[model samples]
Target: MGRYKSFLRQRYRAILGYTGLICLISGLVIISPLLALLAYPEELPLAWGFLVPGAILGLVGLGLWQLLAPKKATSLTLQEGSVIVVLAWLVAILVGTVPFMTIQGLNFTQAMFESTSGWTTTGLSVVDVTKASRLILLYRSIIELFGGAGLAIITLSAIAGPVGSGLTSAEGRSEQLAPNVRRSAKLVLAIYTGYNIVGTIALKLAGMGWFDAVNHAFAALSTGGFSTHPESIGYWDNAVLEIVTIVLMFAGGLNFVTAYLLLKGNFKSVVRNGEIRFQALMVPLCSLVILFGVAIGLYPQLGKAIRVSIFETVTCFSTTGFATVGYTEWSSIGWLMLILMMLVGGGAGSTSGGIKQLRVYILYRSLRWEIRRMLMPTRSVTEPSIWQGERRHFLQDDQIRQIGIFVFLYLILFCIGSAIVAAHGYSLQESLFEYASTMGTVGVSVGVTSADAAPTLLWTQILGMFLGRLEFFTVFVGLVRLLRDTRPILT
Candidate 1:
């Protein structure tokens, strides 16, 4: 047994060592919900809910780390990094469900769904928060806060080496805010912490109680839409709260690099950023279109219409999933507009999930260049460039092709997910809406997801949320690596 354990460690240091450390970290996260009970002691039994799994996970993590910790820190291959990310999420979802199972009569499927939703920052839930304990509610919010921080960034500060950078990149973050991996990780953590503090305070001043404010701030900045009330943000009916959440959600959905630049007063870079410019244009334009639809049919009053429009549009664009008004009552046009927003998603390298605005900008620019090429003579040349932080670099053909493929795969997955849901007897539009919500990681369900939902549909939604959050490739590559890794054992 000892010889085999040693052999495994020697062969796969990155996988076993890093995954063990991550499990340890997740165990700590699982226990942190106890602080919520300390802050608001609503249900005493809920402490046991988290404690049992937390302790078991901690022991397992300790055992794995002891057996597998590498003698020295080393870089991880892209495949290794991908495996670590995927493995960490699988364990996270498992441990995250402990409290849910303890809290109610939820089966493993329902608990897994809620846990995946929270950790992925997808915000879809089968449990009702109104009936849930404060500790459970706080635990859900805490999941978003850390989940938004990205497991790589959180664990990177402690794990020194190029492995951190590889893990960050695997999770879709490309920018480095500081010199070393640890410093970069810490800097991003600081930025996220600052945002959490400021957002919580702002929400509190906007009329939410301290607990609700903290939870909503965590959810909004994480783009996780778990709400204390069933109506989401609409329950408050406070314009101030809505506006505060809008700002936080937008900020949350922004690229960390852009946010860092803006914080440093680099306004010019933000202005030149292609993703920012695209979001600035697309958000308001889509809102106006939805507004027009709502004005004619849903809300006749101008003020009411405008508020709902901006709230829903920002929520959808940011992939935050909060609802000020149910789109079920909206016209088909309204639903289509929001669905398009969900498909476009928010900035890459941010907590928001979907096909991403960066790819959309690239694909759109590529489209125009294609048309120009078709119209011009064969000998003519057109420079296709996009604005980055400080410079304008011409877009490469490979880059364009990759972006196109990503968008194509994303739409394909959406259709596949929709088909799975539609097989359960839903209409085309309903399936599209539900799958779009899952694929975008945007939790605004059109009546498909629920506690009573079929196990197949529930699991499909779970798979969709996981794939969407990781943007597909990481998980796929991880699976391939897993098969390869296990071949020796199987043989």
Candidate 2:
């Protein structure tokens, strides 16, 4: 009984320590939206929208900090780490909705949907962008910036020691940018910030105004897909701007390690990357499938068809959520190809979300190797291997099994979400498309999701976005931990 009490005390202290740190970080981040009001002095009175909430969070965080100060070296268990991450995200979404809630005609539910969508980088919007204020637009863009950098990477860097590696992994990252967690965090921030700067300048040169350029840069590079305009990329109709966006989105979808390599001037390593090669092969191939279908009857103009085909293919493949045209207007064959691209999303370790290209490559290679083994003589021995960057790794049964399970769960969630949407009186095709977009974290809408969407469907998509962004395992583990810890209360 004494030992059990000690265990509970330790766990409670850990929660307070970690959760307090997260609140402090979130409190500081919450104040960033107020900068938008500053940028537009005419909206000065709107400052209280962020200021009130930011002050409350900041005070709460400071109180926790003083109340549960750490004593000595502390270690976080796997369960604690996962739960902390889950809690942090939930808090961020809840706090992020404050500004949206302050706006008229938007309620708590709509505010939460938008907040989750932005922080998850899902890019879906419940409110119309054209009708939103400049401060609101900037706040929306800034949240995507936060999501792209990842709150875990930012906050964990300050306090994560030997035990903190698991914290980063909980956020779905495997690579350590540096041996020291802090240095690794700084390196990642530098690269992410650099891309935003370059992408913004490139877009401005391509004929976008300063305000639009900054927001679009944040969205495209994060694969967040939030647009300042109602028509999205189609709003400008500038081929140069579209091309520039395509390039930035493609870059964003590539693994961050690939970006690090380029920054380090290792071109050869990038060229040999398995995910890079697979992406190169799939983009044009998928576009051709779309082009062929659209060219036959849907779009008679060759130029228009080719342009739309490439844009949508890249958009879906990258999971960037930007649409040049309404995909529902395309043929069934085109929709299939686009949906397939969403399933086989961008590379692992990228801002883009989905099953990820690495897993797809592994599955494909494993199947081919299996075929060869079946045709070989009974005694013949064969081993399957994959090339990632310059390293070669022989396929292990365990690794393949894990990949298979992740992909399976992802699809299972997609199907379940789609069924729920269909229950609300939408067609299967429409339900599947929107749910796939939600579960894949790809933000394309088929008009089913809106301010008027059923609350059930809204909550369903929220679950999909949260699960999809965390990639299932973290949330699953977190839930298991929560139940296990609550046994005393249940009794």
Clashing pairs in 2: none
User: What lDDT score is found at residue 373 in candidate 2?
Assistant: 97
Residue 49, candidate 2: C-alpha displacement in angstroms: 1.3
Q: Write the per-residue lDDT of candidate 1 for residues 77-119, one digit (tens) a residue.
A: 6777788899988999988888889876589999999999999
TM-score of each: 0.95, 0.94
lDDT of prediction 1: 0.86
Compared to the true structure, candidate 1 yields what TM-score?
0.95
| Per-candidate alpha-carbon RMSD to the true structure | 2.5, 2.2
lDDT of 2 by residue, 1-491 (tens): 66776676667566666677777777776677667655578878777887787778877877776677465436666667677788878888898899899863578888899999998988988988878887788778777887877877776666635445666777887676677766777777788899999999999999999889999999988888999987899888788888999999998798887888888888988887778889889998988888887744677777777878888888889888998888667778887887888878887877888899999999998999999999999999888887765467799999899999999989888899989999999998888888888877888888988999888889999999998888788888977887777775334
Clashes of 1: 0
Candidate 2 CA-lDDT value? 0.82
Task: Score each candidate by Cα lDDT.
Answer: 0.86, 0.82
| Highest TM-score scorer | 1
Clashes of each: 0, 0
